[model samples]
Target: MAEFLLEALSEEIPARMQKRAAEEFSQIFTSELEKVGLAHEPANCFVTPRRIALNIDGLPLQQSTVVEERRGPRVDAPAAALDGFMRSNNISRDQIEERETKKGRFYFVKIETKGKLTKDVLPAIIETSLKKFAWPKSMRWGSNSFRWVRPLHSILAVFEAEVLHGELDLGHDKLVFTNMTRGHRCCGAEKISVDNFAGYQDQLRKARVIIDRNERKRLIQEEAKKLADAKKLRLREDEALLEEVAGLVEWPNILMGSIDEEFMEVPSEALISAMRSHQKYFSLETLDGSLAPYFITVSNMPSDSTRDATIVVGNAKVLRARLSDARFFWDQDLKSKLDERVLALSKINFFDKLGSLGDKSERLQKLVPTICEFIGLDNVNGAVKAARLAKADLSTMMVSEFPELQGVMGGYYASADGELPEVCRAISGHYAPLGPTDACPSEPLTITISIADKIDTLVGFFAINEKPTGSKDPFALRRAALGIIRTILENKLRIPLKQLISKSLDEYPHLTDSNELLDFINERLKVYLRASGVQPDLIAANFEAGKEDDLYRLIMRVKALEELLASDDGANL
Candidate 1:
């Protein structure tokens, strides 16, 4: 058994792309290894903003020779066949052997394949993978036609505790393989030498780099919480933010900063989004669950109390500037009534092919009443009112400044405009069950408008034949479909899928067959059920979306059948 390690260290990779790039680098390399018949344990892939490294263990130093028995033409077969077999295998006829079979004696050959040295073959695998690496986005720098997620700095490749000799071509330049890697750009040792993965990780750690993203996340989370807890404030626990912040630093130093009371009066969501999106800072909550005056940030700098305070003060200064801009957007947006902005949406195109957002807003207003009537929602007025104002915030200055606050700013403006509380809630909650973990909108007005909003967009897009494909969903139609499914299941609404789709489709100018859109949602149902732990076969066996379009009833049937299949009688049957 032998060990192989590879590290591609470069300029900081985007936090969003680091983990995926690391996983892909490891996978493509291992698969390339597989093609050359090198069997090894799973690759241990580590990632940070600066580097993606892989350590593969238990690999044979040389591929084991393979022996295969070949059946040739029969003893009396044509001479051409014998000659062809010999030529195909690059072997002489004398190398062929004779074997006795039940029917008759037959000509056979035992072919022995010699194995190549793992070290000799490894360079090609590494180079091929590096050349063919798939990055979501890549760039070339310094007049190099060779593109990477970032510029190539160095390649560290070692096998069996020896440096694997290789060089990677970078269009105009080249990266020679080495056994050395540098540590933290600012703090750690400038140069570190390593012979194996164990030593590499240890040396890198001492040099102030934690390559493992999860460990980085753990450190940030635990330390951020500790910093917050000491002041009797709670860390807001934004997992997505935490994952991203972890990716931004090789070494995380948690520091807390104070917010001004003036900015605290701004909606917590706006403050949180501004901090999160602009500064990558974590918002702290008070013991009573109100937004605390303090914010927590993960810094890449080394820190003592004095240095920590300096870092926090600097971050706080930046935050204050950003928060001031956010407050300005909020103040500017409120000068006008929420409905006064509705006309401006017409200027904002939903898509060139589809009409303006104002058109979509009007469609939503029309669709809401239909949903209210279909679902017997008595808050028809509030639902329609909410639908009208739901997208009104899209044109607001605050949402333009912080797009994450689109629906959130709408809710705030609706409350300021003194719209019904239900309407404000409906507008804010409409984008819900954003992903699997987010809660579905349960309130009547919310459910009414949200479903209407999703349905209209889905049907219109499906009509345009702009459906999401295998690798791409530019419009997030899959998420919209899943949101619809979850809303129905969680709210136990007895709405017919096709009827809802058809009503929403009626609002569109084009009328394609509704089947494709219906099927798309059904496929999403299969996905949703499977994610909820319903067995695939059971879902396939029980799913009848076309015949039973009522999602609540459909899921109920799936659940009942699942229960029956678990019983002894149903199991045997």
Candidate 2:
């Protein structure tokens, strides 16, 4: 047994693509090795901005030899058939033996196959894997017809104590595999040689590169928190941001920078969104849970007093510029009321076939009143008001710049415009519970508007025959359906989904009956219930009982069924 290591060094890969690419590399290599009768103990994959590395432990030095039996024609068959079988098996008639079976006697040849060295098999595997590598988006560089996420640089393949040298034909050029690789592009660009996984990782670390992405993320989090603690601030946790930052650097140097006092007056969400989305900086919060005047950034180089100071200053300046733009949008948007922005939505297309967002908003306004009535809520006026302005922020300058703040900015604008409190809350909460685990709105007005908004989208899309199929939900209708079901079940609302969907379809003149839309929502409900650990049969039984539209009651019945099955009498059934 021996260790094997392979590294493909290239230009900086996109942060989103690094993890998936590393996974592909590991899966393809290990599965191919196993298919060739070369079993390995386990494989570890590591990725950084500039490299994807795989290390396999307990790999056999060579494949095991095996004996195979080749069945031939019947012993009494024609001479032509016998000759063809013998020729195909590369054995003469003298080498064949007669075998008796239940059907008839047959001729068989026993052949012994010699095993090949692991190094010899790996070249073909590596070449085929590279040629078949799939990237979400690939580009051809120079004159090469070979497509990669970026330009091909170098490949390092080592087995035991020897370099497995081979050439990868990239159509226009050939990349020669060797036992050499370079480290951090800035801090260490010199060639480094290694014969094993342990030596490769050690040398890379000494050259100012951390090839392990998880290690980089841990260091960033721990060191950033330490810096925040020293300044009497807390790091606002963002795992997505942390992963992205880790993928953007080989060597992470956590540096704390301060936001200007003037820009801190903007909404914390806006400021945080600006820094995190545009600048890739992590926000800090004070002891009182308010936005702190500081943010943390990770640099891709080793830390030095002078260099760190310059990096911090440069980052702070960039953040200030981004926040200044955010502030300007904030001040300008406040001068106009959210209701005034409603007219501007006509210019923004929601979807090519679904009409404008302004049209959707109008439909929502009309649908909320009926939704409130069905749910037995008396706040129809407030629900209708919220529906009218929920998407008004889509036209706001702040939301135009930061599209993630759509509903959030509308709430701010509504509050500033002196709208009713329930109205403002409803607008803000309409898009809540976006995912399975996100919070669901419980207030009457918010629930009414939220369900109304989602129903309009579902019915409109289904009416146009644009429903999600398989794994391709271009409009995220599945998420919208899931959100609706979660809100209804969590809030214990007895509103009939089918009835509301029918009313929603009525509001759209061209839309037909919403039976198909109702079925779609039910499918999403089953998925949601199954994911929540409910048995599939329980959900099926509940749906079969004709309580699918009333999600709360259906879930209650499911719980009862689960309990009944847990008891003695029902267990027998």
Candidate 3:
């Protein structure tokens, strides 16, 4: 048994690419080893912006020898066939063995393959991996003609004390592999040579680099939490964003940066979104649970600077500038009525084949009321009005510049337009549950409009033959369909999906054939049901989009049926 460490050190890999690349390296290498009759107990992969590392445990010292049996020509076969079999097996007639069988005795060839040393196999595996490794995006750098996620920095392929030197000619003008690695750009103790994994990790830590992303994340969270506690503030935990920020840097430094007093007047949601999206910063809240006047930013440098005050001031200046832009857009958008711009959406293309957003918005107005009644909404008028004005925000400059804030801006504009409170809320609420855990709108009016808007998008897109197909959902129909399923089941609404989808598309004469569209939704439902722990086949057996009017009831039945299907009685059926 022996331990192996394989590291592919490269220039800064994109944070989004690091995790995937690490997983691929482990999966591909494991499968390749198995293919060559070499097996290890378990292999672990770790990744950061600088390198991908794999640690294999209990790897065999050498591949095991194998005996192979090859069938040859029958005992009484032609001379030519016998000669060919002898040549194929590398044996003459004297070496061949005759075996008795039901169809008379047959000639057979037995061969044994000698296993190669672990040292010899490692190099070939490493070279093959380098040549065949897959990446979503790669590029060639300098004149070397070597392509990678970034320019190749070093190849630290080591097994115990010996580094595996394969046939790969990967070296840049200044970088080459010899078990040497540089530490953190700001804090570590310069270049050092590592004989093993421990030496490698210790040397990197001294050089200011945290080679493990998970450790860097822990340090970040601990330091950030400490800062928040000192100020008696609560850290707003954005775990997804935190993981992303963790991958963005090798050394994490946490600091609390103040916001401009004037800029604090900006809505907290807008301010937080701007900070998180643009600066990769986390927002802080006061002890009383209100958005605090300060936020936290993680810097990729040591926190030993005497100019920390100056750094916060400079960061505050940048935050003020960004927040001012949002405030200006918000103020300007509300100075005039949004209704005046509803007519302008006709100029903006929603889809070339399906017509304009204005056309879709118009259809939504008619469909919303029917959906509201189906969802048992008491405020049908409010929901309908909200749906009508939802896309109206698309014509605003704020939404034009920041397209991600479409629903958000609609809520703001609706409030500014002096619409009823429920109507204003519904405007933004319709897009809720964007993700699995994102909140579903509890208000009936909001739920109705949300269902109508999503259904319209799914149906309209399907009508135009743009349905999602296996691993290719450019239109995000799957998400739209899942949103419908979750909203109906969560809200306990009784709207029949097929009826609603058909009625939504009924206005478009070109969508007369709704069969495929119906099937698309049904397929999407099966996916959703299966994901939510329902047996797919059992769900299919009991519930379908075609016959079911009440989606919520159908989901309940599907779940119950799936439970039975997993039981002994249903398994027999």
Which of the numbered candidates is closest to the native, going by highest lDDT?
2
Tens-place lDDT per residue, model 1, 70-149, is: 98888898999899989888889788998899988788888999998898889888889999997999999997888888
Worst 10 residues of 1 by lDDT: 540-549
Instruction: Write one digit per residue (lDDT tens) for candidate 3, span 1-573.
Output: 787877777778888888888888888888888888887878888887777888786778888998899888788988999998887778867778999999898998778888987867887787667767878999987777666888776777777667665646654443333566667655663667776777777777777778788888888888888998998999998897788888888878788888877767666777787888877888898878789888888777777677666677778788888888878987888787877778888998988677898888888888887887686667767766777788888998777767778877788777777888888888877887788788888888778778888888877787677877678988777777778878877878788666787788886767765446656666667777777776666776775434565667777787787678789998898
Please list the residue runs of candidate 3 whose C-alpha ends up more than 4 Å from where it truly belongs after superposition. 77-95, 170-177, 307-310, 535-538, 544-546, 556-573
lDDT of 2 by residue, 79-193 (tens): 9999999788788768999999887999989998889998898888888778777989989988888888888799898888688868788888898889999998987999999
For each candidate in turn, the TM-score is 0.92, 0.97, 0.91
- How do the candidates rank by lDDT, highest first? 2, 1, 3
RMSD of each: 2.8, 1.4, 3.1
Clashes of each: 0, 0, 5
The lDDT, on a scale of 0 to 1, for candidate 3 is: 0.78
TM-score-best of 2 and 3: 2
In terms of lDDT, the poorest run of 10 residues in model 2 is 510-519
